[model samples]
Target: MTVTLAQAINRGIHDAMEADDRVLMFGEDVGKLGGVFRVTDTLQETFGTDRVYDTPLAESGIIGTAIGLAMYGFRPVAEMQFDGFAYPAFEQFTSHLAKMRNRSRGRVKLPVTVRIPFGGGIGAVEHHSESPETYWAHTAGLKVVSPGTVADGYAMTRAAIAADDPVIVLEPKRRYWMKDDLELPVTTEPLHKAVVRRPGTDVTVVAYGPMLKTAMEAADAAEEEGWSLEVVDLRSLSPIDTDTLVASLQRTGRMVVVHEAAQSLGPAAEIAARMQQEAFYHLEAPILRATGYDTPYPPAMLEEFWLPDVDRILDRVEEALDY
Candidate 1:
């Protein structure tokens, strides 16, 4: 069956709630309004107010409460309405949610999933379109992941909810409407692994979430220009599947990391550093990145120039090939 990425996520939440009595979701506008993106549409109605409901307009309060709920054996999914809005909850997440399991010496399990709709391309307001995955991914004890495809959106959400550790699921706001013909209960791909979406030998392009499709599109377009680009999706930001990435680099000998976030100090920087350390001998060219400008997410009118797009990715691919 064909389903949009948003629908796939909705299905994932439905399956999760049905599978576990302890699985519950809460966030701003998630109850009657069905989330700002409607990804939680009809879920509150199906699961009832007890299992799926709304919370006050407080990101820190929402996450702080989820941590307590997790301690009580409830697998809570807390949504941070927008990427920038999640900043207020950083203290609760890093201090408590990400530390409880270790603080208790493995006696406590934090089955909390913090779902964030992140990245830009929708030309929305500043705060509504920020890519902040690097913040959570860098935090210790937090397993950070972002889904690129419809299947991953379904499977990874379930995987995050089932795990005993805290998981941050960053959904690409721009790619939510992307549709694919994958059925529910999708492929059993591990949440922490990076997968090759397209194969080639000339160059490797690494991306995830909002930038995955753009990378793939650039790869396809590169073929007509007589270049072969392999696209790898880094599904898990933290604990990146470096083996998969290094293996691809071993074959291609060149790579370009792309993301919607700023290039400096973002996930791309960490991945590039890892490749330099792990696959330095095999690299034919220095790793390059095509990412958002180092400034604040630009206003909607100028976002096209700020966010990474097909041309930007292609330019990086061409540069990698030229080197």
Candidate 2:
């Protein structure tokens, strides 16, 4: 079926709810309004108010209550509306939802899925376009995963809901409208594994979510310059697919990490360090990063300069190739 990425997510939610009685969802405008992106469109109608519904305009309250529901043996999928809006629930998520299992010595489990629309290129106002996945990924005990394509968008959501622990789904808002003709009932793949988007040998580029398309585009452009760039999509940000990444780096001998988030301490830094540790002897050049500047996310007008594009990614690849 040909469907938009957001519609695939909606189907994922429907399948999850149908497959598990414990599965339920709540978030701002998710019910009657079908979410700000319409990703939850008609979900409440299909699942009913008890299973799929809306919550008050409180991020903290929504997450805090969802945590309680999870601890009580329910699988709750709580939407944060936007990446920037999710910060208000940080205390509830990190302090309790993320720590409850460890704190209880395995006596309690938090089977929760937090769906957050993240990243830029949507020309959205402030608070709607930040890539805050790093914060959640850095926090211990939470599984952070992002999907780069329509197939992944469907599979990862089911995987996230099935996880016994907390999982954060950082949906790329800009890619929501992208279309794909995927077979229905797509089998779920390992949520923590990375996949090669394009196979090459001259260099390896690692990216996920909003940046994966950019990385692939850069690889396409690099081919014309006689550089074969392999692209790895780091699907799981927390427990990164080091094995896949190392294998790719071993083949290419050079790596370039790309993301829309600021460069300092971002996922790119961690990926670079891991490649250094695992593929140190094979590295032909230092792992370079093409990322957003250290400053706050620029206004929509200047986002073109702020976010990484094919040219920026190619520049980093050139540096690595030259080395």
TM per candidate comes to 0.99, 0.99
- For residues 1-323, write the lDDT of model 2, one tens digit per residue: 89988999998998999999999999999998999999999999988999888888999999999989987889999999999999899999899988989999999999999999999998888878898878998899899999999989999999999999899999999999999887877864599999998999999999999889889888889889999999999999988989999999999999999999999999999998888998899999999999999999989999999999999999999999888
Q: What's the lDDT for all of these models?
A: 0.92, 0.92
Model 2: lDDT equals: 0.92
What local lDDT score does residue 254 receive in model 1, on the 0 to 100 scale? 97
Model 1, position 150: C-alpha lDDT score: 92
Residues forming the 10-long window of minimal summed lDDT in candidate 1: 180-189
Q: List candidate 1 stretches off by more than 4 Å.
A: none
Each candidate: how many clashes?
A: 0, 0
Colliding pairs, model 1: none
**Tens-digit per-residue lDDT, 126-168, candidate 1:** 7999988888888889999999999998999999999988999
Error (Å) of candidate 1 at residue 196 is: 0.4
